[model samples]
Target: MGTFSDPTFRDLMAQRPFLRLWAARLAGTSANQMLMVALGWQMYDLTGSAWDLGLIGLYQFVPALTLTLWAGHVVDRHHRGRIVAACLATQCIAAIVLMAASRGHWASRELLLGMSLVFGSVRAFQMTAQQALTPLLVPMNLLQRAMAFSAAGTQVAIIGGPALGGLVFVFGADKVYGLGAALLAVSCILILLLRYTYVALPREPASLATVLAGVRFIWQHKVVLGAVSLDLFAVLLGGAVALLPMFARDILHVGPEGLGLLRAAPAVGAVIVSVVLSRWPLRQHVGRTLLIAVALFGLCMVVFGLSTSFLMSLLALGVSGGADMVNVVIRQTLVQMETPDTMRGRVGAVNSVFIGASNQLGEFESGATAALLGPVGSVVAGGIGTILVAISWRHLFPALAKRDGLQAR
Candidate 1:
């Protein structure tokens, strides 16, 4: 019942601290979007090899996967706001170095990848802390709206960041890097402006046991485990993004412009859905809704795979994006609502790893399957696999399937 036109949305937005946090998310995510574009172009410019282009993802993934547990541990035991600020500061420094490297022609492939590694490392901490901090800023009733609005910001960034990066890159690589640094600096300032305070968990001595606790907690919580793993496997098996280029170039024969549209289609869909969700939140059947959305995502993937027509393909991808946004809001809300503050950092870390796995590993899966089955067959097979995963999850995780809403029990 919370439309943007309604007082609920306006009331939530009017809160000073929450608005500040929202601004920080927008600024930081936009910078992330710009950074990805610039980094990819720089990598390809340095080495024409597509393999190295692929390694940029790998470089980022390795640190996020490896450091996530420790990052969560630090988040719980420390001031989350300070931790986020420090991470942003580190990223600011990295951006400056990258800008200098580009301007001085001091950049090597190794140096670029190393910077990518550093950026990834810092991002793990920043995201974990930020996720944990969000609940602290908004009251329970407004959390769902807050997340939807937050998601809209990300979709906007995803849609615009590449275009912005490309425009700045036209001027100079350093200028692109400078823009990223400046945005990150602004994000850091906004986070500092947030009046929300952190209530840190009691300090505990570092131990292997402490680091592993998040994994254990998730394992024991059936709903959380089910929600997280559902996304993991569904995305892993359903991932058809890596095959889009093949579809655009070979099947659709749309070339570069068509490819750009195809890539943007999902984000466009996501933006629309996110805006709508922020206005008209899903207040009932949260678990079932999530499952339905993901299953539709799988079906859309199949439709996309089979389509030779460009418009049809775009429509299918758009629908898939819309469905995925639903999954994102539902899954994120479930995780946040179910988690205790003491465990939020660890749970967030677990969620982050699942996300990284689904994205990075999913790409690899798509590419390998495409090579084995041809792009169409590979995508179709992945879609089928995703549907199967959804079906199995419904039966396997009945708790998640039966759950009614996002309100904490």
Candidate 2:
């Protein structure tokens, strides 16, 4: 608690850019979290099957994957604030459309899937822009602290949004979408409050030179590559949150309200851990910290998968989330601190591709695994696979851990 409540740390946001950035991130993340629950609940309400929810993920991933490179390049070339505003605006429109469709009698899963595609695409761009803007907001010494603030805002959003989304759905989908739209709309307004006038990227338009340069830079930088790849595979294999509805409806016999808790449990764990990080920092031994955290994440997944009880599942997920939070802080610090000033946009994009690999694509992997093995078996197998990958990676990429932090490593 000392880390979070420390006056020194809170004073770090004395700068206007950091304050505005924090508010903007908080607003955006809350809306994003609301959409996550709303989407899952909406899809399940329509299809009543895990397979269809998986298809919703399939629709979302296509655009998130397809447009990443172009989005990165555009972010590198344009005004990031404007880019973020446009994406938020697009997402606002998507939410309104979704609400309208939900209110109508003619709603179809096909149309909803199309809407997901659009939102996912815009989100990809928005995320890249937001990440690139962070280093510009705060100095290097505070990057880790900045990440904790970011994580906390996201955790608040994740916890609050789903809890509220669950309640809003009882009223109607319109209310849920209205809440998401309001949050995102407010985010657009708050982002404009940034004090600094960051010049857009120079007009030396790149053809293939910039693209390959960014990719090669990341490839050559083992630290960046390793940190991202760890998240990519761990979440890819061990992510069980995507399938919470199945456990909620079929296994644990809980309603949407209980489902909200299941969904929020992980974020709650993350919030707690993030607060700790914000207070005390990771100390030394960043390399070993990351490995231990990820290994713990794998262990938690295994426990969660085998448990049949609702409470057990929540506990397991909470542990997994806690471990993942440690991993997230370490990796984000690595990325933000290590990335060069000029290459932030493209570098952020590369990171997103890794995140996409971890999340949307991971959902697909989980879905496929569930179909092959049952849900229980799939989660256990995935968790075990993650552990094995961590072990293999440690041996295969010994340099990744031995490497130093940030620029000097």
Candidate 3:
């Protein structure tokens, strides 16, 4: 294990281009997190309806699902940094418009939903471009460390963005939106300033085969298939984020400020784990570690669902975040190491879909189930489901369960 002052850590930090990319990612993610906090809180405030809050997630997922594959093709063909920058620019515009609408007293559930659609569309490209671009910035040997470090940055944003948004909400949702817009603009500028090695590949014509290539590749590679699909099902069932507003207001009796703490709890755990992983770089029993981490995440969710005490709930969520960070670092490193650079964008797009489904669509699922089962029942049931999925994957993908390391053998 390496210390904070380790030579490798310093080498990664000293790479100017990667540093710029990391800065841009940190800022952009922070903006996105703030935007989501405002949107979710505002939507609940407007309707006091779980379904409507869930609808915000559904709206975002729809465009991401529809466009991500096509976006992957574009990512492969175009300059990845510019694509990321363009996505940030679009989100900044959306934030500005949302701020205007809020201040103008014209922001409605419909307007929020519309902007969510725009966010979903832009994220499809942004995620693919960013994932593909990372390998180009640093040495392949450092890729795993780079991912862990990047995750550390993302976790910081996740923790601070919501807390900041919640604090800013005291002023108005408009203030939160305005601040998010500014962060996004700064992220866009940083991306524009980034430089990396780019080799233009021969342009390939658009075809169904090309678009579906990432999907086919995953299916053919069972290890990759197992890794991505494990996340899809586990997170799909275990995700409790959509119901957070209800928890904050109705169950926990914690206002938006408390909601911020709830939102930040997971990232608190995630950042700590990410920093550890960045130093140590898991080198053994990675597959078993992945499964154990997921099962632990499910257990935390169960604890969270049953807890009435705010402190207990936060503890459960924070622990769950740590477990999830472990899962993320392993899965991302595994997928990227196994893939060729040419297909990274497409594969990353597919990976993004699984992520989107687990997050955004999972929100929709949580809302619908909460409507039927109440939030407590829905969450408890989902937690158990997540545990079962992990166990089932262990049996179904034995190769993944027996796997040993991040690097392909």
Candidate 4:
């Protein structure tokens, strides 16, 4: 009975549709994370080259960046749930193909990179639809809490996915892909069960004018633009994730299991913060809060880059992750709350591109720099760059810095 008193949990449970969506997200995210771990490990194992590892990120990024605008337009005019379900099914098929390839001893760098391209394209559309659909599932007042809970679910997947992937990899890489396919299947089923229809805007003729509206909207909304761009460039410059496999194998002297632990550490810290935020949302000086958190994230990156001891590195990463969680919750809430329903898909698309670019391009930057400066120097320089980005953004986006709360203006 006392458990029901928890407002975040209670609200999440009360809404069956939201619950279903949450579960589906958990399944899909976990599978994706697991697959990522497998892919990274496999790439490193096969090529033994950091440049090849960065190519994995590049392969994924290209499709997303190219198709993102068109995908967002499609999402705005379609049944979002069906779109998500279809995307999940496609990903499942891709995973099954990877499993067959790996099991048959036919998996190669080219095949893995090709799969990354496919999944990245599907995800470009899926992410826009899913992000747009979220605000429609729950009441307006509960949106922040819902986002917190949703992020918590993602954090949980992040925690379990790599660990599971690592454990399953011991059996075989094929087994990891097989499990990913299964989870993706489950995710598709869950999304198909959700009940909601989007209130689509009047369909305008396909033109640059229509497609480019989202870009203009984001540029005009200083808070949204600033928040998204802050995350974009900060993460772009702080490319710690790209060098993770190198750390796990060469630096830390730990195997796949250690890689899993390193991947999971940030999520472990993130889930804790998400749970807390769900219970008590941030209410004041939200913009400043995000800035401070990002700065802290940069500082922690510096610590993580310099650390040699495994435990100390994990601690540094965990703290960095906790700080990132703050950025995610507030930034997303602002984007959703500020935008109208008609514009959500398009706006979300812009945000997704920024995010995708940061991660994938960041990976490329990391790998390239690691080749030139070594992993330790590359990471430390990136951390210093992140700190500078934060300071620069604060001065540039005065509207974001001056904001007082998460509520829509």
* lDDT (C-alpha, whole model) for all candidates: 0.89, 0.80, 0.90, 0.88
- Candidate 3: clashing residue pairs, number: 0
Question: For model 1, how does the per-residue alpha-carbon lDDT over 1-409 read when each residue is reduced to its tens digit?
Answer: 5335688888787878878877888888888889889999999999998999988988988998899989999998999988999898898899999999999999889988998899889989999999988899888877888888888898898888888999999998899999999999999998877776666567998699898899999999999999999999888988887888889999999889999999999999998898888788888888888888888999999999999999999999999999999998888888999999899998999899999888988998999988888999888888888888888888999999898877997
Candidate with the greatest lDDT versus the true structure: 3
TM-score of each: 0.97, 0.87, 0.88, 0.88
Clashing pairs for model 1 are none
Provide the global lDDT of candidate 4 against the true structure: 0.88
The residue-by-residue lDDT of candidate 2 on 1-409, one tens digit each, is: 6434676577666667877877887888778777867887888888898988877777777787777776778888888888898898888888888888877755678877777888888878998888888878877777787788788888887678766787888988778888899988998887776656576667676577775555777888887788888889999999887777888888889999888788888888998888777766765778767877888888888888888788888888887888899889888888777777677888888888888777876788888999999888888898999888778778766766665454434
Which has the higher TM-score value, candidate number 1 or candidate number 4? 1
The most accurate candidate by TM-score is: 1
Ranking by lDDT: 3, 1, 4, 2
> Once model 3 is optimally superposed onto the true structure by TM-score, how far is the C-alpha of residue 396 displaced, in angstroms?
2.1
Clash statistics: count for each candidate: 0, 1, 0, 0
- The Cα error of candidate 3 at residue 179, in Å, is 3.3
Q: Mark the regions of model 2 whose C-alpha exceeds 4 Å error after superposition.
A: 1-7, 35-56, 97-114, 242-259, 308-312, 370-373, 403-409
Encode model 4's per-residue lDDT on 1-409: one tens digit a residue: 4634776657766988998999999999999989998898998988899998978877877898988887888878778999999999999999999999988988899999999999888989998999998888988777888888899998898778877898999998999999999999999999999987556567677678777778999999999999999999878877588699998888888888788688778888899888888778888898888888888898888888888889998999888888999999999999999998888888999888888778878888999999999999898888888888888888999989888878878
Candidate 3 residues lying further than 4 Å off, grouped into runs, are: 37-56, 97-114, 169-178, 244-259, 364-377
C-alpha RMSD for every candidate? 1.5, 3.2, 3.1, 3.1
Q: List the residue pairs that clash in candidate 2.
A: 3-279
